[model samples]
Target: MPFTPFHMGAGLAAKAAIDRHFSVLTFGIAQIAMDIEPLIGMIRDADVLHGPTHTYIGALAIGFAVILVSPFICRPILRRYNYEARAMRASWLACPEHLSKGAVALGAFIGTLSHVLLDSLMHADVRPFWPVSNSNPLLGLVSVDAVYQLCFWLGAASAIAWLVGKYRHGRENG
Candidate 1:
């Protein structure tokens, strides 16, 4: 699932449910951060496609990195998007000008850990508990088709829910 939109589906669902507690931009950054090692491995044609970076230990490290950098990255992005939304008179869709440190950390941790968990189910090379054991107990936990369907359905359901919530809220406020 490296470089795939499947991961974003989970992120979207999370954002829909916890928009105030989680920064979607930070979550997205963590997702990209998690995949960078695998992308490099794919380009280098390394024997292990999903190497140490796909492990829980590696995810913790990556999550820390995301927390450190996400403020810098997410702030500018949110500022610009918020500016555009304000200009367009769509404030409800805008993000905060400054994200809290807690939100960044939470999003990063959730994003990276979820990425590892999901990949571990599909990719036999993903040893999520590595450094303790190379055995991938999560491999084949679910079929690839089921994984895709889960991601897609979760995303669809979340999107619908978010939209409905926003619509109802808007009607009440307006």
Candidate 2:
């Protein structure tokens, strides 16, 4: 699923459930990070689409990298979005510039790990535990159609939940 929006569904659900403890921006960055290897392979017509980058070791490395750099990358974007949200009176969409390092790390890890997990189910070439063994035990754990449906429904449900929570909070404050 190169460049697929389906990878974002888990991140959306996590952000909705863990708001302050989940950085959607960091999660998104990790998702992109995970796919970079695959994208490179596709462009070069390499035999290995899912390489070492799809492994848990790779995820840890990518997650740590995101944690180190996400604040600098996300702060400005979040500030701009917050400014626009404020101008539009859409407080629910507003974001803060200061995100906890722990939260960013958590989100990044979740994003990378989930990407590996989901892709492992559909992609026979993904060896999530690469260094341990080349075999992908998780391949075909679920149908590709089921994976798509799950991702879509999870994203929809989480978005609705987040909106409702934001609306309720606004009402209470008002």
Candidate 3:
């Protein structure tokens, strides 16, 4: 549970404006995305890989993967802003602001990796140091029970709400 919201919220915060509703939503989704496999397998299989989302390599790969796809996601919204690219690369653009493709890729990588780190701390048996060597520390710090779940949900909700309110306020004022 901790990993689900934390990872996703980090994703949202990284991709969108820091205080945007969509960022929170995206974070929540990313955090919970891997849970479904385990939940379903718990009833059917005794031993499952818990899916790739739990792995550090998997998280980084997924994050950058999402960023690579972001151009498609931004295309429609960007159209109104008259967004243009200096090159044909989807990852690079020559827009109103001065930015680099590396920045976007880095943001996507960090956003996703944050989720893996947060989740590994809470969930036991997670192989964070995977591929590089599945060596990890037994940092048994937190539990993923009702209270913790509620807190994570609340944090996500609050961040999302704040972002929405800010967006609305900005629209009204602008």
Candidate 4:
């Protein structure tokens, strides 16, 4: 909600829990995709910061775009990542291989959709159901601090899960 990094907590949790079914990398890209509208609106001094891009329709479009693009980007990156982690004796840091198409789609959709829902909680201008209802009933349903805590706790839990997994697999570095 504050920035893309804030979204990583949920992404990491999803990746840790779902394993091969989710990709935090693709989710990060999708967060960027969802935020592009707000970034531009802020830059141009537009009245509506979280406009169309913070809607289900907009998220679907962003997800599709990410699905189409992530493979090309994530594959090469993961190849190098796998190699480097192995070299560093931290094989758990590596993904088995590049995420599958389904995983990419899952991550993209989850990232974009969750971004809208989370922002809707704190931002008044975010009409998550825009063009249909143009109302953000979910707005302020939860406090901003609560959302931040949720993110922090989810990230911590994911990190703990990852560490437990790494050591269980006997691949933890040091």
Candidate 5:
């Protein structure tokens, strides 16, 4: 994935489908963390754009790091979003000011792990197994266009599901 935003489609869908268990905020942070290596490489013109950070082991380490640091980041953002939601009269759009440790861990792992898997499909240098195996058996399995389309449709589905869920919840409350 060229951008973390593309990965966010999955996070949005997961958050929608499993509202209690998934934290899209934490997921987004993990996605950004996964991409940091590539971004830096691209900036510095490094020979290997996808280095060890694109590997499963590295991603897991990053996931744990993100999990540890997410609370400090998630808190203020959640508070601001919830505040804006209240002012806009869209309380349903508001989220808890604090994400449970479980949600943060779940989102971090899902985000980082899935990022590596997805990148493996498109980038030849993406060695998910890394130290265990340098060969990317998953590369070229799908076209880059297909991956983009998948993300786009997932985002569309997430939006539709959210709207429908909101409507249903409003009716139930009424």
Candidate 6:
């Protein structure tokens, strides 16, 4: 799957919303990219799939699935982070009262969904409205090229560095 800054951005945003569910967001983007690029390749003779997965349904389904399983997969991490054991259990059970439950679910869903929508906006001919219509709309300014990839890597690195710096500053001040 092509690594686009669109998806990377979504993943980063997801981290803020879900408190570290970027993996699910990025993974969902990759998954959707893999599924769509091949089909897009077949139709456009480009040798990749980049169509259906960019649709709204794809985003919803994948996002829902990822969010649904997040608590289970991240249980240990949550515990490590000092989440109450009972709260964690309730989140795992999808209880509304769990402190971070909604945030976690929304984070995963939004992050994954954002990747799909963001990719849709960037491509020249994405079936984002697929099963509904097939109009090629261009909503992005950057082309999926090496330059864009560089920007993504640099942005992610910068965000990481800034976060690390802030953490260290806080520690030192404390």
- Taken over the whole model, the C-alpha lDDT of each candidate is 0.86, 0.88, 0.52, 0.85, 0.86, 0.53
Instruction: Point out where model 2 deviates above 4 Å.
Output: none
Top of the candidates by TM-score? 2
My TM-score estimates for the predictions, one after another, are 0.92, 0.96, 0.52, 0.92, 0.94, 0.56
Off by over 4 Å in 3: 2-46, 51-53, 74-107, 146-161, 164-172
Clash pairs (backbone) in predicted model 4: none
Ranking by TM-score: 2, 5, 1, 4, 6, 3
Selected candidate, larger TM-score, 2 vs 5? 2
Encode model 1's per-residue lDDT on 5-48: one tens digit a residue: 78777877877887778777888899899989888998999888
lDDT of 2 by residue, 1-174 (tens): 778999889998998999888998999999898899999999999998999889999889988888888888899999999899889988766666899977898889999999999999899889999899999998887899999999999998998888788778777875
lDDT (tens digit, per residue) of candidate 3 on 91-155: 22222232245555555556556656766666665777776766557345555564356455655
Candidate 5 off by > 4 Å: none
Tens-place lDDT per residue, model 4, 1-174, is: 746477788888987888778887899889888888888988999888988889888889899999988888888888998899989987766676757888998899999998888898999998888788988999888899899899888988997897677667664354
* Residue pair clashes in candidate 3: 4-31, 7-115, 8-27, 9-27
TM-score (C-alpha) between model 6 and the true structure: 0.56
Overall local distance difference test of candidate 2: 0.88
lDDT value for model 5: 0.86
- Model 2 TM-score is 0.96
lDDT of 5 by residue, 22-138 (tens): 788899999989888999999999888898989999989999999999989999999998899889988776677878888999899989988898899899889999899989999
RMSD (CA, Å), candidate 5 to true, equals 1.4
Error of 1 at 47 (Å): 1.6
Report the Cα RMSD per candidate.
1.6, 1.1, 8.5, 2.3, 1.4, 7.8
List, in order, the clash count of every candidate structure. 0, 0, 4, 0, 0, 8
